[model samples]
Target: MRNSTLLLAIASAMLLQAAPAVAQNNVPIRKIKAVKPTTELTLLDRVESDTHKKIYQYNEYGYITSVMEYNKEAEQWVLNTDNSYRQEYVFNAAGQCTARTAFNVDKAGNKTTEKNKAKVEVIGDTTWERYYKEYPDSTTHISEAYAYDKWGNRVEEILYGYDGYNRMEFIRSYKKREYSGPVDIYADNANYTSIERGRLLYDLTAKGQDDYHYTMNTNDLYVDEFRKVVWQTENDKLYAREYGCNRSLEITVGSIEREMWKSSEREFILNADGTRPVRETIRSYDETGEVMGDNISHSYTWDNLGRLLSNIRYKGTSSEISYKDEYTYADDYAKKLSLREAIAELSCGNQIYPEDEFLQFGRIATSSYNYVADGDKGESTYEWNANGQLIGGTWTETCTQSGPDNDNPTTVTDRGEIRVGYNADGHMAWKIDHSITESDFSKIEYIYNKEGVWTSEVEYSGDSWDGPWTKEGEWGNARARKRLATRAATTPKFIDDLTDGSHSIEKHDGVWNTYGNYNVTDGVVTGGGYQQTLISTASVPANPAYNYTDPLMPLEREEDEDAEVASEEMWYYYWNTDKGDWELDWGPTDAQRVYENDGNIVADIYDRNQTIVSTITYRLDDDGRLIEETYSKGGNITYEYLPGTNYLLESVETAADNSRNVCHYYYSKHNYVDPTGIESIKRNDASTPVWYDLQGRRITTPTSKGIYIVNGKKVMVH
Candidate 1:
């Protein structure tokens, strides 16, 4: 996703190139045209109706120097006074942008006030940038300097900020690199060094605080081997530390040779043929550095053709089996078969394929059993079209119980079937799932534009397969393809109005029943009402408020009554270049109380006048996973993750009462494959070597002097 503002600027540049030379003094000036809504099957179209026109001035070097936006009111073009609507730029002799200033303009197109300015200077291998913003009484400035290596890698950076009267250094970061090995095996010259370590220090006293001032230090270490990072460690002063290791080994199991790789927190034993891992194990540890309860492992069975046949999971040192799954595939087909026939055959314990010779080696059924339970099992049957698309399927679960009081075993079953339809473009058009046990059904239908791009999706539910259906929800008009842009739904209310004497409802036996009502006084619900029966009545001291000493809160907190009924919410999106997607650009809204900073919802705001609701503060790891969350109302939750993986090893939640709840999560994988490739330059073979480009395209003869692969080795061509 591209920034809409930057796209507008680029569009202005294009218009300037096509503009006629009719301006005074032959200056290059062009009007910014209204960008039409892109009809290229984009999920969400811009609301172009509110688009305003702007004029851009270009220098002789074809660089944009100034931009002024206008508003058409009363059939006249008036200069927009908004600071963001006008900008000026300065360029150096090399056509490099040196300074950018944004200011407010008067009706006469004269700059009235300087809002903000940024200037940059570059010398040899170093660069400096300064930013200034004007407030009512004082102007604050921030300065940053960077030093880069010859290979264009940043080696050091420093930041300073003005503290009203004096400038103070705030942060310093340094990078360490070593040139012992090639940085890129595919490049013409791979002599550059790689970053091996880094350190960052923060001056806590930069903001003029002495009592709470202590420099914070962060260190990172990266160990590279075989052109890949094999070990990494991070330490945050005396706060926390973590390390990760990745390695591979060759071992023999019985008479078969196998490859093994420790991936993150799990160890995988690959198959002898190097196709996939036949076994995996995950072990966890406690806070005291002792091994926790049991180690989870998964073993897989595959056929000669590399097809999975069965997978079994085990736990603990005793090797207690947990669950087992078996798969069956069709080997040959004589003719095409109907979906009903295929499902029926698989359900009857037959793995026959279609008779029309449509598909071969297609998985037909899978059965899973829980070994912990005497008679708990599930089975799924699938029917696929010639296009290899799943068209129909059935899922069934069966449970059997027998006790001393009962001589015969009783069996219960729940079954469901799903059917899918695809459009001519091979996109899913509709799908329906019918629950045989409950005699209910739900369906989703997709709508596409003339260009065959999916535009809308609607879900409906019905009591039976033949009755009238009720619309549950609809999502459509996504600006980013396949991402939900808007959703509208009319859902049933679970709780009554929050006014005095309001009660909550619970669904029981397909009917909603109202519970006891609650007492409300002064817009705050009292504790000794119906809520007491549902929750504890104990009261704890209010949680500590969020630290506002840093002046980092970008939005003001407001107090309002919590709505118990369904309400609509609107979200604004901004382009995230790192994620290559649109992310919510959040602010204070009636529907949202959380504020985001650096891609994290760091704080929750509550109205001071209303009841003191819990405000949550989050702490994240380097990978942006939540590690700890503290609530101002009395409890905190901490998560222990498997090193270098998103999988959680354990989580502890402490309530306001100081009572703690601990949970452990176990993970297992079957048929995992380790990446295989040569990470170093290899000697070329004697035979005529094959040449290929970086994109893996074979080259008949070298016509250009560049990097190419010869005999599986990358080499520079002269």
Candidate 2:
């Protein structure tokens, strides 16, 4: 494991060094136009509606500096604009802006800024932590302190708050923990202490918790968490990660392993293949401590291109197995893996034994993936401007793999073509994906509001942009096309009222129905559309009255509650009837509905006699978000996002044992927005989606539910 981590650390350093560098004179500044690479042409311009200001700026070299927002207070919409946050920039010799900084701003309009400098530092990138002190009058004083660890990780931050009388109110501290390895784990803790008039107040202490983690893995991971088992190699190599928990595990159960491999400067050592190390096989290194090719044990060899040619494996009893692998690269630098050969040369005693059930009984099996490069396959290249904007590309997939058929031994050919275009503001204007059958052209168009928010998107799969294609459904004539097209760009307006239409009440049978607009504005959506009826609701346990003895109290006295029980029925009937049903049994109501003076749904009511046995109130937030919900009989559960962030902080379970357990959550930027305090969940709280620029293809996902990318091109990891 140590060897694996060391190798990965060295590899990451190399990759970082090879990344594109910003010119020394190019200090990154803010830009109003979406930043773009030099090679691509932008087709759209971003216009700000709030300020009614539009501007575009770039580095001297024409590279985009930033996509900026303007504020009325600033008076001008500049690349490096100001808001509650401060912004700064650096430009290179060609005057190309490289690095920019964003930090909280003070009332003085001053900020603490850092330059990216486009240096792409292979190591030692530092972070700055800013502290703020707010007075009772609502004014804040900004101060910053820097503390970092050996690994260039930030560790702690502190700030103070005061009251209107200039008396200290409290102190806030942010602390972090970072571990060193191929993977890094970070945890944050925040503490607040009360202060009065520049002195300590109350007990003077408050506490909070937070955590973050990152990893550099060689074995590709589908999910970020470590619970999943992606695959186990024949050599017993395994790797896994868990998304929500931000945990990962890697193990090399193999005997012989690759180590100390640094392509640059060619640093490596050769050892005889086995579990134990032997002195005779100990390879030597040169004066620079670099293991030279000459020091390689006879067991390994390399090709002229510096690729590993073959590796020898020992199987004891003077037997050996040799494996070789090779790779070929495309013009664009995409590489293909080809297995050269697997030769097992063995010398064993002449004996026959029945096949093991694990292998022959079909309980377990082996599988291999094969790749054959297509030589005659037409090759294509894509070009994007210097702004990292795509001009075009030779989008094609030619090679195919043949494997076992369980679900179905199938060969998938990438048959569709994609073309992307950008707007003048450097935002994606449209993306066209050609149909596999080559009959229709499928496309998705994005329209961004002045605020840079993507307001609407229209998808079409048709032979052409002309008539005879289904919009959402149904083919349309010219007039229909015009109407649909107009509506396609925007959502329909809400009907003001249904008063003029109809307001009728009818009761033919036992069932009575009333239909009418409930408000003058915003027509009531009813019946088939939204019946606004109850599905089910949670409720308190049957028994209600009891001594409710404190478990912490003396055991002899704890039985007093049972002695006081009026009746067995009284002990069991604790139901809150007003709320229709328990929240879990049915569902929570809209927060807006609760805020608008509607009756709060507490819980379901059950009765053999209905004598007010018991009641339970599931806690709810102002936004109608469920807080700590409890089963009054005994158990209680609470769901909430962590503080200062929208990520699911934890789901806690409280039980009769007087003990509580928690399930924590961590999230990648996708599928989640940074939320402050308790979040308001409108619909799906379990699954939130965000978008990803997967090598330039916009893939929208929470991805947890499951996503198919490129029609079997790959299954997205949750």
The CA lDDT of each predicted structure is 0.42, 0.30
Candidate 1 worst ten-residue window by lDDT: 547-556
Q: Over the stretch 90-117, how does candidate 1's per-residue lDDT look in tens digits?
A: 6566545566665666777656677666
Q: For candidate 2, lDDT tens digit of each residue in 1-718?
A: 0111212322221121221111111221212122333232221123232233223222212322232333345675443233233233454555433343434434443444421121111125444433343334545544333333444433333333344464333333322233221111111100101101111111111112111111112121122211111211223221111111212323221210221122212112322332211111223344345654533221444333223333343332133332222222222321122211110011111101111111111111121112223221323344445554444443344443445654433454455555777676666677666645455677666656434544455565667644233433223245444644566343222222345333322111111111222122234323211112221222221111111111110101001111242212211111123532111222222211111113334553334332223334456556444455555466565656545432234445566566665443332221112222332322233232322222212233433444322211233443
Evaluated against the true structure, the overall lDDT of model 1 is 0.42
lDDT (Cα, 0-100) at 515 in candidate 2: 22
Off by over 4 Å in 2: 1-414, 423-429, 438-440, 444-718
Question: Best-fitting candidate, measured by TM-score?
Answer: 1
Backbone clash count, each prediction separately: 12, 64
